[model samples]
Target: MQTASRRFDLSVQYACNKEGLPSRPQFRGWARAALEGGGQVTIRLVEAEEGQELNREYRGKDYATNVLSFPYDTEPRVFGDLVICPDVVAREAAEQGKSLEAHYAHLVVHGMLHLQGWDHEEDDSAEAMEQREREILASLGYPDPYA
Candidate 1:
């Protein structure tokens, strides 16, 4: 039998001045759809500068990308934070011909999976994660993000 998926306590923080960002409920719904167990997560919407600083400090990258997931604890519960740069998301959405909401949904799912120990570090692992992402997004009525 399948174990019950744990519920999540999610918070959305806006650290940027970007317009057209999604609301807290939207983020919560997306997170809920992706999270597989009991967890607490803070989804912080940041500007490019903060995003760049975080990437530099953590991943040794010098520029901002899209979404970053920081998982703190895992066991009976999962705790983490998801930092997302709206500027990058918007630019990527425009460039990829996808809606802003679609991109955000994809990133939220991706980050939540990371918090659950899902990774794409290897070729086979990447394929597995991508397949799972595709399934989750499709359940949420989104088209293939990789398509």
Candidate 2:
């Protein structure tokens, strides 16, 4: 079996009104745990407007989502961008009764997995993907998100 790689360049930019979000190191750790490749990824924290625009343009949705991933399918392993909305994250955390940090970690990993071409359009795929996410998050000391 081929062992997963642990090489990635991570960049984080905050464009939202919130302050004191998690650092780049935290996001890098999450990304490394999610994907199996040597690559670089840019994680941007943006407002609802930008997030909504991106979602609408890319996904045909008119609202800002919690996270969005853009993967580069080129050689040299440069993964594309992951845009996260803190506002949505906070709301989801509250609704789900999870810590903000934990939810943030989960979303970051989820987005990274998307960049690696993982999807949950079907039930089986979602289960497998979510199980992988649970394992990875657990290894990072987080509780099972689906539990």
Candidate 3:
């Protein structure tokens, strides 16, 4: 677990040609807000093809998803990667009536939480994780993503 300092090393990689992706600073801010300890996190934004490939290869899902967390380590210091599909995010944002920035922030926080070992496989766990997301996003001045 991390100490009070909560320092982290963050890298942002854009593999997609999206026109309006979030900036590196924005990614850092969102990831920092969700940090529970020292960590090295990489955020990769990919095109639909790569997104679908990763989802299929890693999660066995054929379609592209909004975000995926790949955590390698969590003890002493955290190390992980967050793969995000901007196209999927944009589509979901339009469908959910959320701003792109807000939706990105929510996913970043959600992925960070997963890197820290949070799970939503069960009803109880899902409720708790969603509540924590609400609190974190609220603190960041974003509306409830679940609403």
Better TM-score candidate (1, 3): 3
The predicted structure with the larger lDDT, 1 or 2, is 1
The sequence of per-residue lDDT tens digits that candidate 1 reaches over residues 1-147 is 434347678889999885789999999989988877788899999999999999999999999989999999867778999999999999999999999999999999999999989999999999999999999999999999999
| Alpha carbon lDDT of each predicted model | 0.92, 0.86, 0.93
- Model 2, range 1-147, lDDT digits (tens) per residue? 433344567788888764768887888888888867677788999988999999999999999999998988624564689999998898999999999999999998898878877899999999989999999999999999999
Q: Is candidate 1 or candidate 3 better by lDDT?
A: 3
Q: lDDT of model 2 at residue 38?
A: 73
Ranked by lDDT from best down, the candidates are 3, 1, 2
**Model 1 TM-score relative to the real fold:** 0.94
Q: What is residue 67's positional error in candidate 1, in angstroms?
A: 0.3
Highest-TM-score candidate: 3
Best-first order by TM-score: 3, 1, 2
Residue 104's C-alpha lDDT in candidate 1?
A: 96
Error of 3 at 40 (Å): 0.1
TM-score of 3: 0.95
